[model samples]
Target: MKSKILLNLSLFALLISSLGTSLHAQTYGKNGMVVSDHHLSSEVGVSILKKGGNAIDAAVATALSLAVTHPEAGNIGGGGFIVFMKADGDVTTFDFREKAPLAASPTMFLDENGEIRDNSNHKGLLSVGVPGTVAGLYQAHQKYGKLPWGELVQPAIDQAKNGFPMSFGLYRAALQVSKRDSSYDILQNFFRGPDGEVVAPGELWKQPALAQTLEAIRDQGRDGFYKGAVAEEIERYMKANGGIITQEDLAKYEAVERKPVKTTFKDFEIFSMPPPSSGGVALIEIMNLMEEADISKIEFNSTAYVHLVAEAMRRAFADRAEFLGDPDFNPEMPIDHLISKDFAKSRFENLDLTQASKSDSSKFGQLYGGDHTTHFSVIDKDGNAISLTYTLENSYGAGMGSDKLGFIFNNEMGDFNPVPGITTSTGQIGSDPNLVAPEKRMLSSMTPTIVAKDHKPYLVIGSPGGRTIINTVFQTVLNVLAYDMRIDRAIEAMKIHHQWLPDRILYERNLLSPDTRDALEAMGHTLIPTTNIGVLMGITYDARLRAYVGAADSASEDGAAKGY
Candidate 1:
């Protein structure tokens, strides 16, 4: 008995040591906190908070700064969603999701014989959507920001004009895009130096044109980009490049304020972006399905837990592809039914604890979104919190940029169904709900979500992973709310994804133990390995310490968590 007691004591000590190490990886702040894909962007946000700006102001600054620092995903040329929760629990969401051009059609990407034309939906000029980031940010600021807009915009302009040290991640991304075909010549030239080589890590990289555009925005607000000289420049570039976005589209663009989707799991209240973004609905559905199980009894990351969660993800994604779309376009979508606990229970009526469920593509649509998006979380001293996610559809967008503007345009139109009735095994969906329509926002999986406990903001989290965004956010929330994990542990934990089509589970490399893998395979699961899953930015309120604990995913080399 004495020996056994000593062994247990040693085990407890080791557990505490491990937890301390994990906690050390996080940044804590009593006043405000920001976590983003780039260290400089995070720092920019923290500076705003220190200047007495609230979460909304810090979020805008962080996003704009990322447009300069993390060009691969952040941009004024892209659009996305934002979920904000005030100290009093007042919740709202902004949908600045990019919209299809006025000239776009349901079958625009199809050729004469109804086949896809040179992957036109995903490449070159026509792929671009009318940008919404600037409008979105402007609207949010106008409604909730307390700081001057110019103050929020200045940091980004300075970063672009004076330049910042190039990160290895940025350098690598630029080098790869530079190697693309001549179509990306302008992009190549923008990143290449006088010696004609890609900018090296730690080297200063500047964008004078982008600086001038930012100056216009800082001076004129939304019109700076959507109306005057900048808009004219975009129209001229499009006309010369066979693109369809025009000055009219730019002028007509506006970000809509939508009611956030709210749901409850146990003692927590969750709020996320609504349709236009499939993220909120899908995330709620998956969580509802998960709520039926006593997950506390299951070992974390065990085959059983993974299998159960994957099944839930599969069902939710199946619903996502079939019914969800821009709410303005598909108003009758069964959102209520999809997110109900009864619906989740009915969907899981069949008990299959021993075998993996088969994902039938014919019965559901497949995902066709890109993994190159960015997400950031910010919380202020006033207890207001923001979860914002933006994307360019693909890495470096269409692998090109406008020489005059010095910014990449999103290939967001590719997120729309390329053809009607053409769902493919390789993850292509042709659901009517998401078919291209002039001025329609493309469906997205950018799930920026916040959780509140006892009517106070507890967790502000989001990730950039295309179709896997929903699943990643779901798992991280579960790790904290259900499994009682530390915020840092929750962010670093390996994640898995199952998107209903292709019928395979995508697990992070070495995420599963050999025994767990063999057991899962024995249960008829086809598991594929991926290098990484999502780059998450998250903050959790530590009530005992009375501080905000922020963590940036280890998967992102340049990610940081900053606070004051």
Candidate 2:
């Protein structure tokens, strides 16, 4: 077994090097049976695949392992959503989003001046939501995993216990870590170094508290994290820092199970996490509208093609802001009604190819709904695939550290409305339905998704950015499905993004044609060139070949998608 695993790992490493050698563009990939957000992380999954574990086993292991290896972005302390598709065509949705604290009210973030305060909602205790990461992981494993839970979790434990060398990705991402709107007191102690500066990257960092916490979870199951000493530490940290989280809040948190939004696009059946996430709904709306238009005949990346899709995105985003939310709280999310062919046509017909619509026109017009989201997708060799997205609302999450736990708590509450606001639901001034409330999950923009072609799953793609998540994921998918690019070619392909707000189409500098930008501008669409489009992690599969093709974006200087 050791020899076989070592051989597979070596073969995988060789594959990555060969693939990377051709790219001065800073891209990454390895052709294999497995793929992940980071090449090294992908190698971890490949090792598990070699050791007789399926993708779920390897994915669960790698997902947890990312905490130690990819600590700059996510960890066990953060919460997210997971959508699993089994080889047998079974699918499950796990909503492990952070729930609001019991003490939270609609007006929690309102100050004496009756205005929303960033610090009040983004840091300290009020920002920490009831975490569901542990529960979510367990739920995924319990249903689809083959490896023993403890064994699967051990990789993260070992990495946390015995620190891993920091990679360039961490070193660079460290530069962008945001402090709380107002620095947290504990945060001062949390990230400070021997010289009283924020700890720099390439430093050998280990979260002993996080290691201990993971160990306890290993020994005690989900209870160890959510209902035990770990929860106590989180609550205590909140109080000590003037935050509002409490024990009851932690105890009441539950990872939700929602129906995966099902849609038919091209030759495939698609399943995605539904609202409180507008990603799925908006994606469907975009698809429904685009499918009615013959885009391929126009040309890939042509002025007209970009114009049509960008316009579709605009309209869909507008509808997103006006109608989408946590379905349980908002009775009129209009998900089904909106995505329905007739309804989509009404909205779609309102679009103009000759002129870009105003920001006031799209569903996701104000869709900066949440920025705390990130994603990872995994496929079991058995043909089961999972799309998972998690976040802490922003960089380093609330910037308040339970350093003893070796992880930052989230400011996901900032995702909520600050005041009792008007909404069609409740039809009165109250918690905007998304306002912080005990056990209520915050909204998100993380859009981790997989597409099937010809009744077979063909692609797994997702991105990490606030509103950019939608456009990044959308454009990448089109590159493969519409353009038929290989996995490496498809993912390394440049990104293009447009949001309803700002009325600007943010172009990844230098990647697109000057004509494309000019075309958009001519249509009255505002275009802004950006330094980095956004980092993307995607795996494109070839069903006939019965193999996996994957790539990570180099566009952001993030080494994450490079597979070892």
Candidate 3:
């Protein structure tokens, strides 16, 4: 059995290298599977599964593991949403997204002159939100976890305490930080040595502080961090840095359980995170528009098909910028209207087909809604599946951590529109529903989704790419379900994205041919080349074989899909 597993991994690695992606992108395992952007984190989850844990247990383990092995995207200092399906056919969602501090205000990021404040919401302690990751994971475990909480988090604790070798992926992620800038406190604190040197790849790095932090949370449950020493440490740093998060805010933080948005496309049920995450609404709208237009008629990856996808993406994002926000803060969002087939049809009719819409064109849009966020998908032998996407908002988050506690804070407040109701060059008011507000969660595009066919788990998927997340997942779904590509091909295929305001179609550098770019340009679409848009981590289940197929985005440098 061990030999067979090793052989499969070897073959998978070869296959991945043939595709010109990192060997870390190789697929692994059949019975139970874990796919994440970090190999160590994925292994941690696989270990949990081997220890008789369920999909939820694997997910929580993977998330915690990433907080240590892949801090660029995974983080305890951040928060995200989780969507899962139980073996008995029940689907659920948990929204543990960070919220604005009590002292937050709608105009807090606005200057005295009523203009947007420079970097006010992007950097420093003022940009931090009340983190909900610890609460979110704990709540999920309390309800569904099959393993003890301490057991689930033990792998992460060990990794932090004993140290792990920094992989090429961690090296690249660390390189993204500007070590010279001491103001980037989180980045500096994470990668810089006390002597002002930077940690490099292949080195064994340990974080005893983070290990101790995790151990406390394991021993005392949620209060260990939120109401005790950790909370006090966080408050002290904020006070010293002109930030407003208080112990009261930490004690009051709660992860909410919300209804998953459910919809159908060609007989498959799509389940996704609802609001605070514009992801589900926007994704549903885009899929509905594609269904209404029958976009499958065009050849896959052809300019025509890519153009259709890009147009659909643009329309969805335009709607998102207008309507999607924290439901509690913007209760008037037309959730029903936006996700309706009628709305998709109306929006589709405005498309010219022969040419791109003018850049400045104004239209009422129903769209839905990554950064250094990490995402993972887990499936256990019991048929339970979990899709989770979590983040620190940006690389290292807030570019600083609590000096005493040695953990970073999420810059989620940066997600809110700093200056609401401002007119843009596109002639539409920018970010109305998503404006800053006290105790309100910021709007996000992290779409942790699970899709089913015949009431069985078919696909579990999510990604990390800031605003590009929704579209990346959107295209991947199309690649597999609509175009009939294999899961690996669906993940490796060149992708394109378009957000309405930017009015430029962003495509992988070599994915589209010169002629394709010219054809798109001739059709009035502006095309821009980019190295990457996002990394998608996912797994699909084959009921007939009772096997799980895993995949990680080739665009990423490190990730693994392993199962046992």
Candidate 4:
């Protein structure tokens, strides 16, 4: 068994090296591990673990650091969810998903003609949601963190104040956002150097303003961001720009502790974020449907396997569009029914193994979400694990940032259904469950999940892909638990997505052979080729090695798995 484990480790390292990038190799540690899309952030997290901080402490520190190093998605100006699992199996979730402002209404994005105006729902100050990252992190730390709050935040402040070398990924992202939306002077000033050129890769990019903001948070905890100086600055910016967010909206924001959605797949218990994230419910629903089949009997990524999984995805996503939303707003959302094994069985009963299911948009709402988000996974020696995903919706969010605040704001308002009754074949959903309302969190596909066996964490995993997030996580979990693949191999494996409304299977380019593609098409499945699906950060506990093994998806240009 030890030799086999060694062989598997060797194979994993070989695969990493063969990826043709300077990516970090699959990492292993007896004490702790952190896997994220940025090497610096991963190192910061591992440093916290070495300081005797638990997984939660490491998570807070890691997230804070990413806000400095990886601005594309890692953000204090955004919000997300956290799925936490203690070694003894106690599980909980924190919902800090950005909320619609008090002044937001169902048709706020519509113009005089009742159509979306200037893409207002996704483009400017009006698109920004109430920030929640600071509140969520602080709340989690207050309850479970062992390190000083100041200590966790200090690293981010230092990174921003002292500056860090800009990576090619960061440089490219900054350039892309600037070019995509040239109207935001804030973004232009932030990305451009003294010569009026975009900051080049490897240059030391400093953010003194962000550092000052972090310093306040470090000194005052949650109130630092939500109540005093930062809140006032945010209000001033909004009012000056015709945006609606106010000091009251910022002050009223609170991250809520909620029960995690729990379900069993074979011998493993899965825990993930619940509603206002459709992730957990949809993931379990898909898994439960897949559980009915002997997946092992079918070859991985074969036509038959893809068909079965896509069918499952189709049915689950249909349910997600119709029934899932913020639990606070839709108390009767059939949570139990949606995740139940019986429900999955019934859904699977209608799945034709040889035919593709039609995704009628009229029957289910279309998904409107940004494909840019960040996820990190951490586990300490004590077996505590955290799977957290956050985003500034649509890379760099709203293409705007505050020179005074030094952080971008989330355009998360776009996640809400914009029109009241406008479900369209072109993939626009007007589902009432996700309509904008005061303080209502928009529905999300950010599924931070932990899979456990025998009351200990076995796998901690998540990804960043908007509507594809749930499916990406679903496939990864299945890759490990069902197909018996190592965590690294599971992450590197090709992925596919099938959201209900699109009625198409999106497969990673070049993975599906011509024959397989032909076969799928023969079954009436519309196969669309795409680039990498998600940048998955995952860690698994190797019971045989009595250690944690981590993997950062090869698709991620700057991702790393750090451990100590």
Cα RMSD (angstroms) for every candidate in the order listed: 8.7, 5.5, 4.7, 6.4
Cα lDDT of model 4 by residue, 1-564, tens digit: 999887656655543442445555678899999999888889899999999999999999999999998888999999999999987889999999999999999999999899999999899988999989999999999999999999999999999998776666677777776776555747876866667788676555788999999999999999999989999999998898878999999999999999999899889999999999999999999888878876778899899999999989888888888888889999999999989988877887788999997888777854788999999999998999999999998988886766899998989999998988788876788878999999999999999999999989999999999999999999999999999999989988889999887778999998889999999999999989998999999999888989899999987877899888
Candidate 4: which stretches are off by over 4 Å?
Answer: 1-22, 194-196
- Candidate 3 lDDT over 1-564, as tens digits, reads 999887656655543433334444446466699998777788899999999999989989899888887777688888999998998878999999999999998888778898767777877788888999999999999999999999998899999887776555566667777453877665665755446555555555678889999999889888988988889888888898888999999999999998888788998988999999988988889999889888778888888887888888888888887788888878788988988889988999998788888655344332222267878899998889999999888767777886556577888888877765664553333457877777899888898988898887888888988888888888888777788776787877888888786678889998899998889999999898998877888888766666788888765666878788
* Model 2 lDDT-worst window of ten: 422-431
TM-score of each: 0.95, 0.87, 0.92, 0.95
Question: Which is the winner by lDDT between candidate 3 and candidate 4?
Answer: 4
Name the TM-score of candidate 1.
0.95
Clashing pairs in 4: none
What is the C-alpha lDDT profile of model 2 across 1-564, one tens digit per residue? 999887656655544452343322323223334444455565567667667677677777777777666654566767878777767676768888777777778777787877767666765667677777888888777876777888877777887776554444555555445343446444454444556665554444455667898888888878878778988987887777787777777777777777778677567676777877777777777777766775556687778887888788877766666666677678766678877777767876777878887764312245333453556666655666767777766766766667677777777777665555433221112235455566666667677777876544578777777777877777777777667777666666666666666567777688789977887788898888886654666666655555665665664332343332
lDDT of 4 at 30: 94
lDDT of all predictions? 0.89, 0.66, 0.82, 0.89
**Worst 10 contiguous positions by lDDT, candidate 3:** 361-370
How many collisions per candidate?
A: 0, 20, 11, 0
Q: Mind sharing the TM-score for model 4?
A: 0.95
* Backbone clashes counted, model 2: 20
Question: Which segments of candidate 3 are over 4 A away from where they belong?
Answer: 1-28, 175-178, 192-197, 359-370, 426-429
